[model samples]
Target chain A: MSIEARFRIDRDDFTLDVDLTIPERGVTALFGPSGCGKTTLLRAIAGLEASQNGYLKVGDEIWQDEQKNLLPHQRPIGYVFQEPSLFAHLNVQRNLEYGLKRLRGVTPKVSLKHAVELLGIGHLLERKPHQLSGGEQQRVAIARALAVSPAMLLMDEPLAALDMIRKHEILPYLESLHRELDIPVLYVSHSREEVARLGDNLVLLEAGRVQAMGTVSELFSRLDLALAHGPETETVIKAVVAGYDEEFELSYLDFSGGRFAVAGKRLPLGSAARLQILARDISLTLEHQTKTSILNIFPATVDEMTYEGTAQITVKIKIGSVAVLVRITRKSASELGLQLGQAVYAQVKSVALLS
Target chain B: MFTEYDLAALWITLKLAVITTLILLLIGTPLAWWLARSRWRYKFLFEAVVALPLVLPPTVLGFYLLIALGPHGPIGGLMETLGGSPLAFTFTGLVIGSVFYSMPFVVQPLQGAFTAIGERPLEVAATLGASPIDRFFSVAVPLARPGFLTATVLGFAHTLGEFGVVLMIGGNIPGVTQVLSIAIYDHVEALEYTQAHWISGSLLLLSFLLLMSVYALNRRFSVVKP
Candidate 1:
């Protein structure tokens, strides 16, 4: 089961035309720059925007088409806006119940208690919306949406309105929601860090068009995509915790690429974790160095290379079945005689454990 | 110091204001909501009609209304065909007149309040499974409470001060069509200065209190976030 959507929306200044088939589970991020039709697509799917010749089907349910157009309230969806728009008249508990009370004949998939616990908003149930801080209000808003137990969750930059501190405050609850819920999520964001940390599938949009669509790793490291040539270019690795070195306080994560040693014992053995590797953090060598301070050294095959500006070059290398990127000066590329399909050693200097 | 005629006029004035306010709210809410949210290009024409009483002289409006509610007019002719008397000189006629006379007072504040709410809250409510009517009562109305209060007070107070419209249509029948303002006008015309002063002073005090309470409650409401 998947979500199939085709939308063409024309405004005075811009047009959004796209056809997409998104997976039914996990977080699929609509990643793009501002005014790139990311929010428009999400709203069209939620039946909030009227698009010309639109077609939308979530799993087996047909929400919109030539003959059928469901209203926003009629569709089984929970949408979290960029602003935490809680009702001023209702307290947190009543706001949460607002949706639940309107769920005509359909059994709620997420109970109010479960939603409150998930967002950690149990203490705020009695307080009105104005009494809560911005972050707390957003959490209550999230809980209020969850209490409806929608078939799919649509989030349009749920953290974009918050400051850095408040964003950090809410990210963990979002992560837990991703982990614990079975509902598919369409997360719209322009932040690369947010996409890397929370997204499983990526739909890259540019100028109201789909630039690329694939897994987060595939789209980030693809040489043909603009994401590979930027300063913030990075790749995400899904790995399992193989073991924990208690004495050294390091956790070994195993992926298709290789085993990564991260300085943390927080993740239990066999649990899944995500690792973020930056292109600037890796260097290419002609031979394996046994006398290096770096703990991770893997034999990689150079698959592709692209020049970055005038002085730097970005190279895509494959370690086992996984892909990684290395940035080197243009001068170093020629001196070392790098070529496609050439086997080399990739030395990593840093890796960020995303989750 | 108040006579039986003065008391009767006071009672009639209060009754007229209360009924007019209640009737205005019942009809004004949907009209204001539509005016605030509709995308029709011709909506301004309707808005201008609703606001006509604000700029037009009260006697002019009353002249047209008196024709409309009289025996020869379409509304009164239809009523007569349905085995009813013409509404020209009845309490119902004053109510209809006041509803028209004070429409802008009730609707403009409501339309402004509804517009200030923006689309986010209603969209949020709809996505959360609220139907159209449900969203109106649950979200829009509560959020626009200050507007409602202002509309109510202004509608009531403006109706209490009606004189020209009632004189044109109601004919100032004491203890029936005569209200406080009409009774004061009669006192002044008859050279009863003391009775006119009493009624005028009471009206000034009542209007002041009504307006003051609206401001106080609206301040309290504004303190709460939308």
Candidate 2:
């Protein structure tokens, strides 16, 4: 199942015309700069905007088509907008129950108790929205959306208004919600850090057009894509838990052609996880070095090179079958004669465990 | 402490106030919502028309109403064609005059309530799977509770105080059309100062309580900042 969306809407000051498709599995983030119609697309899909055109299909159901138009309330979709948008009159529990009660049925896909537990809002049930902290309010908002047992979930920058501390507070809940729930989620954000943290699939948008759409690793490491270059550019690796290294109090994570050792973790074995290696944290060597303090090393092949700045250049390399990006000085790159297809080794100073 | 005439006046007052408020709410809600949200270039013109009764002298309106309900006028002619009474000097005519006279009291509060909502809550409700009517009852009505309270009380109280319009159209018939305001006037005209004091003092107290509750409750609710 996939979401097929095609839209062409004209506004007084701006017009959004684009067509895109999203796979029906994990979090597909509509990532873009602000004012690029990312939020408009989300609203259109939710049936909130009537001036929109084209077909919008989620799985087997067509929310909007030339022949049929489903009203927002008629469609089973959970939307968490940028604002927490908790009903001010209702307490946290009643706010959540508002959607749950509307979704009347015998076979409920999401249970009230389970949603409360998942979002950790069980204790905030009786409190009004204004009484809750920003993070707590957003959590309850998500729980309220989830309680509807919608066929799909659309989150439009749910944490955009929060400060860093509040963002950190809500992110883990979002990550865990993604992991625990099986519904298709389409998230929208322009923050690369947020995309790196929560995105399973990425759809880069700019000026009301799609820039790219692929898995996080696929977009992050591809050679031709501009996303793999410049500041905050990083490599996303899908790793599986191998075993625990008790002596060093670290977990051994195994990927395609290398083993990554990180700070100790308590995850169950064989569970999948992600690793993000910043481009600035990686160094390249022509051959294996013995005196290096860096422990994580993998055989790398230069895939493509692009001059990012006068002093620094971005190098895309293959670690077995996966791609890793390394930014090196122009002088160092020239000394090694780094060209496409040249074999080398990547030395990483550190790697971060992304959920 | 009430005479049988005073009781009839009270019943007339209640009937006028209740019917006036009920009719105003039904006619004013959608108009207020539209006034709150419309983008028409001349929308202010519509607002001025709705508020004309607020500043228009009650006698001035009653004078026009008197002519309009007379058998020779267009409205009375239409009623005659439809096999209905001309409606002047009747309780129904009193209600019509009161509805027009008390319209601003009901519409202004309801409009203020809808405008204060600022569209976000309704948009959120729409996204949360609430139809327009569902959201109106489940969200907008509850959110606008204080405003509704104020509007209803003001409409009722304003109708009870109506004198000029009822005098012109209702003709002050004691049992048929004499409301409390007219009854008070009649008592004072007969040199019954004590009975006048009783009736007038009751109306004054009732109006004062209605306005006091509006201010106090609205103040409290405003500070609560829902």
Candidate 3:
């Protein structure tokens, strides 16, 4: 099943036109720059934006069509705003219960106790919103949304308002949600790191248009899209924990491409983890070098190459079925004679295993 | 030490003010809510109309209201056709006048509070399955508590001290239409300084206390920042 949407919203400064079908499971990130209509698209799907000539359907349910439009409250969707937006007149417990108590005989997919435990907000139940930190309030907001047992979750840059430390504090809860929940999530963000770590599908938006939509690895490794050209370009690969070495503190991660040895992390064997490989952190060589300090190296064949500005070239190389990105200086690329279809070795300096 | 006339005036004034304040609240709440949330370009015109009493002369308002409520005018003609006497000099007529006079004091604060609540909280409530009406009662009313207190006190106090509107519409009918403000004016007119002092002093102290409690309570509630 998929959530299909077609919307056209015209504003004074910008217009949003989008039509696509997003998978009805996992997190599909609406990634874009500011003023790119990410939030507008999210609002449209939630029925909060009154856009003319719009159509939206979640699975078999028609939320909005030419004949009728569902109001925001009528849609069985949970929304997490950029800010916490906790009700000031309500205590933390009542705020969480606001949505739960409104459930009109719909079998709840997420219970209040489950949501409270999921977000680790048990102790703050009796406190008010102002008494909690920015991160804690957001957790409560998320738990409140979850407590409604929504069919789909809409998050518009939920971490955008928090500082670095606060963002770090909340990312784990979000990760747990991604891992544990089965609900479809339409997550909107401009940060590549967050998307690379969490997104199962990526919708690249620019100037109110859908530039591209594909799996996270497919989009991030494409040399043509801006996602691969940005300074934050990264390759995300789904890998499983193979084994751990206690002597030297290293963990073995097995992906479709190959196995990688990374700095030791406490992870259960055979559990899936996301490995983020930044383009800049990867270097290329003509041959598989032995005795190199780099611990993660795999044989790859060049799929495509594009010039990034005048100084560097971005190469998309396929390792088995998975594609990885490598950024090299023009002079070095010319020296190595890197070309499409040429087989090479990619040395990854670091692999960030996002648990 | 107060005479029967003074006591009657005190009771009549309290009744008028209380009735006027209640009616204003009942009618002003919806009007103010509409003014705050409407996106029409001419929404400010409605706001200006509601706030007109704040600056317009009470006698000018009373003059127009007198014409409208008199037996010959449109409203009075309708009342006459309905087999009712003219409203111009009745206690009901005074309430209608006070509601007009105290309109802004009640509406302006309610409008400000509703506006300050903004669209986010309402949207959040909607996403939480709160219908618009549900959101208003559960989210908006509670959040705008400070503004309601301000509106109620200001409306009541302002109505208690009304002179021109009541005098213009409700001719000084003792035990019926005679209110504190009119009684004080009558006392001074008759050179009865001591009688005027008692009514005027009580009105002054009552208004001051009402206004003071509003300010003090508003300060305490402002710390909540709903």
Best DockQ goes to which candidate?
Answer: 1
Flag regions of model 1 displaced more than 4 Å. none
> Which parts of model 2 are misplaced by more than 4 Å?
A222-226, B1-7, B38-45, B184-195
True contacts kept of 3: 0.76
Per-model CA lDDT versus the true structure: 0.93, 0.87, 0.93
**Model 2 - which docking category?**
medium
Recovered native contacts, candidate 1: 0.80
What TM-scores result for chain A when each predicted structure is judged separately against the true chain A? 0.98, 0.97, 0.97
Span of ten consecutive residues with least summed lDDT in model 1 chain A: A264-273
Q: What TM-score would each prediction reach against the true structure?
A: 0.98, 0.95, 0.98
Per-residue lDDT, model 2, residue B195, is: 91
Clashing residue pairs found in predicted model 3: none
**Candidate 3, A213: how far from true, in Å?**
0.3
Candidate 2 lDDT over B15-89, as tens digits, reads 999999999999988888889988889999989988998888899999898788878778877898899989788
What is candidate 1's lDDT per residue for B114-186, written digit by digit as tens?
A: 9999999999999999999999999999999999999999999999998889889888888888999988888
Which pairs of residues have clashing backbones in candidate 2?
Answer: none
Question: What does candidate 2 score in Cα RMSD to the true structure?
Answer: 2.1
How high is each candidate's interface RMSD, in Å?
1.1, 1.5, 1.2
Report the Cα lDDT for residue B35, model 2: 93
In terms of lDDT, the poorest run of 10 residues in model 3 chain B is B217-226
